[model samples]
Target chain A: MAGNTTPTDFGNPVINWIDKRLPVFTMMQKEYGVFPTPRNFNYLWNFGAIAMVMLMVMIASGLVLAMHYTADTKLSFNVVERIMRDVDYGWLVRYIHMNGASMFFIAVYVHIFRGLYYGSYKQPRELLWILGVLILLLMMATAFMGYVLPWGQMSFWGATVITNLFSAIPLIGDTIVTWLWGGFSVDNPTLTRFFALHFLLPFVILGVVFLHIAALHVSGSNNPLGIEPKSDKDTVPFSPYYTVKDLFGVCVFLIIYAAFVFYAPNYMGHPDNYTPANPMVTPPHIVPEWYFLPFYAILRSFTIDIVIPFTDIIIISSKLGGVLLMFGSIAMMFILPWLDTSPVRSARFRPLYQKFFWLHLAVCITLGFMGAKPPEGIYTVISQICTFLYFAHYLIVLPLLNKYEKPLPLPPSIHEAILAQKK
Target chain B: MGNPHSHGAQCSHDAPQKHGQEECPDNGHDESKRDFIFISAASMAAVGTGVVAWPFVATLGPAKDTLALSTTEIDLSPIQEGQAVTVMWRGKPVFIRRRTAQDIELARKVDGDATAFNSLRDKQKDTDRVKQSTFGGKEMPQWLVMVGVCTHLGCVPMGQKPTDMRGDFDGWFCPCHGSHYDSAGRIRKGPAPHNLAVPTYTFLSENRIRIG
Candidate 1:
């Protein structure tokens, strides 16, 4: 049976169709070189390729899930359960899709931090990095909206509370909330809109990713040295070099991803979500998804209540502070390329900067942890300190240290750096 | 630098074999090509193994028969008149409700002619007798049982009380999308396209009943 086909026969309809419609292999050869890529790319570079693979996996699994899914609010949850229990290979598809979301975020976080460490956002690559950040935001939104479609208790109340956050705005807040809900409350109209947006945003992220890649291609990848290739002699073909590396990385990633899907599918899920949505009984503590915990913490940190001058309206002081801090965190990243005055590029060459960067990362993670926990007295105090440090690292220390700290001598080449380190 | 192709050169070939070195041009090309072929073959094998293993890994849970039989029967004894109880059958929700006088009256008065029983009889003449055996011949149905899953999405439909606008439903209200079903679990209003399914069942006694 296998003898009928040659390696280049391309008898498979998919292979034949691809060959006819596009120059996939040729493009791979030309742009990547027949064996394209820098020979020395490290694990940090693996995430982008891993993310692409994850995107494909998520889309494939999600498509299968959508086939068995009922968009109607009443049956949506049950249909999801059916997909988990009844349809052929449905459980596999659902687990993959669900875990794929978590894996996507994991890869993306690592990808973003890799860019940060290598200063991939410097100079011409800033726009590419910014676009990547936008893609991250869009992804968060898509995941949030998709989570609500299950229509479980958490899905419903989470949607209701999150959508109601718009009411925190001034005069138009209530109107905006109503418009978002497509009704006076979170009902069928809200579910329909959430579904539509969830379906639509992935394509938006895809388009943004295209632009992100376009930007990356123009600048090329930043190496650990953060120096441009001096000549063709310095650069290697991308294909066999990076492709094999990326494939290995993907295999390792899949092992971890599979463990989560098979062993603890509900580890990241909220327990209250198992119950059906009951609008009358609010869940004791309303928390967003794990990914959104940091921001949720930031939103809850303020303790004051502010009354509009000469008006009866009163607003919680902490929520406003939290909102500002959240925006500040993201907005700070946009200005990072200009904020630091250090002559050095990579974090490896900047000892003080590296220390501060690690400290800031720790603070962000601590804030995220505190966000998920209830705001008791001690937790509140710790969150306040961490939140303060998170802002201080970006707003004050980074800029000031950039001027004062003396960076280490730069290596002319990665090869020289490695040799020097060995000696 | 040592000759690139010297049989025992100390300079490693792991580095990109530089040209204009002692190595023969043809030998360098052949070596690289061989490396490419080996790497490609290894990658293909790994990918093939992954693809084959995915299904088995995903299906590590119980077998089909075990999962099917995991469904447990629920008792409907405590369900008072005008009350409903939700039970699990085949991992999907099944609702059992006992109808009140007004519910039966409203169901009978629905199209002015009370011909639903006749229509049901006409549709399943052979199965009618067997199906009717459970309900018996009381003028009012003391109990109504159905899968709580919405025909549209499978949400558990809430039992609407007789007095509330939802209670006027005489059956159940699915809050997920506002689909309403009548006393007989027939889709009455909203987006549900099919009637709520009734599971295979046998009543053990008056109050105690078993559902499969």
Candidate 2:
């Protein structure tokens, strides 16, 4: 089996010597060089490689920013300013790291949507999907902690408000918040620890990314057609074929990222964050980074108290409900492989599922918009509705659709699909 | 043997397997176009990697210059009694107030009417708010020094200016979120979870203060 061993070349003395010991080169050759990939992958498939490249860009830029950044709350803002003005190309690095975070999310969201559309989480690939969700959670933590390192008004208050959410936990809530702060408030100790964790988390993400790819390679890749390669005719060597394709996709992604970094660097960032952290003044509107807007919107949606039916008891406060709902939205994604009960993997073949998939995308984007806006009259009403649909599409819609919807007949193989297209 | 490697026509059906190589169905698709795409792709990847690498190398320079500017000293003589002045110390606002006799009396008066919010947040009393008789320094009950930023979300309070409305307690009122501080810089009311933080400062010969 392709999964068992790499084809080793004993002809070269160095490769022959290494194969006997570690087999590193042989494994690379087998896994990446000539690995069999489905032939008919589309542009959406390119996002996985694009996400990987963006990760590289972020880490490279972040390492430099960390070297120059003073994690002390008193000096963090000043130190970052110095990096922009005094250090050579410090501005460029800071901008890229800042914008790269947005770009990373852009690619990741597309990558996730591609998975959802093609049913990449089905059957043998369930573990691969779980690994991807783990990466998303880690990425979120890394980004949140990284945002606090600047120690601007937004950074300081953002950390305080977000960490304060834990205080909603019943018995040990305040203690947990205190432990997280390492002091009475989000002060020097909090900054120091967040910096340490922020620096350390990317490497942990790198480890999980490795496991994600390993799980992917174990089951081979899902294709646009959402079918297995029945014969050699249905597949191509990964090298020179997908490598060139991925490289092209990565370059295109980089061009967009560079445009943001060089031109509109602060476009995605909040203007109030430029001011140094002052505990006395709060920005009139406190919204998180754009990447977190959707979740933020969901969190804000639960404005009214949930009264238990048949009783006048206000069992769950609106505050606690919002927290649970926000977390539950992300948690639903972790169990998606189970939640989506469709026999046919890809939405392309499933007519009823395909329409709801687009609805899901629209609901998410709407929630993000609502999150960015203050929960006023119309936005509040819309957010509650969108949050409902967002959960329903996954939980209620997908499971029910599995039994009722009739799928279109699939092509025999990837080779035949391409052949039919040519004629 | 010169043409030993020569295979059939370049199509999936014509040559499904040639030696150990598997032929993809789309092999006959434009070769020159693919070459052009690959070249552009390779160049862009190189540029992206190069752009991100420049910052990692430039930050190797020393960042020690900013570290030395952490501690600051302010002249208390210039700040008159019945007035508080905000000073920039280590990138944060430090509120220095030379308290009047009236102000001290108002803060010390027993308040059975309202809650002392600062006591719950900071666990310190009005007497403990000052550097009073601690570290053998001269007890200056008339002088009050605290970080000017509010305990809520880090906005400087409004009571520093005489024209500014000091919330009902006749002290600093945080206009940002309605956190009102007493004459002694203790939290009195509003959403602020604590009092204005008191930074570590000692009187330098009773006319100057050195703060870190």
- The numbered model that scores best in TM-score is 2
Off by over 4 Å in 1: A1-26, A34-36, A305-317, B1-212
> Best by DockQ, which number?
2
Task: Score every model by TM-score.
Answer: 0.62, 0.69
lDDT of 2 by residue, A272-371 (tens): 8899987655565777999999998887677655568755455665556777898999999899999887768888899988999999999999999988
Cα deviation of B27 in candidate 2 (Å)? 70
> In model 1, what is the error at residue B167, expressed in angstroms?
34
User: How many clashing pairs in candidate 2?
Assistant: 9
Most lDDT-accurate candidate: 2
The candidate 2 chain A region of ten consecutive residues with least summed lDDT is A310-319
For model 1 chain A, where is the 10-residue window of minimal lDDT?
A1-10
Give model 1's docking category. incorrect
Instruction: Judge candidate 2 at residue B55 and give its lDDT.
Output: 75
The DockQ values of the predictions, listed in order, are: 0.01, 0.04
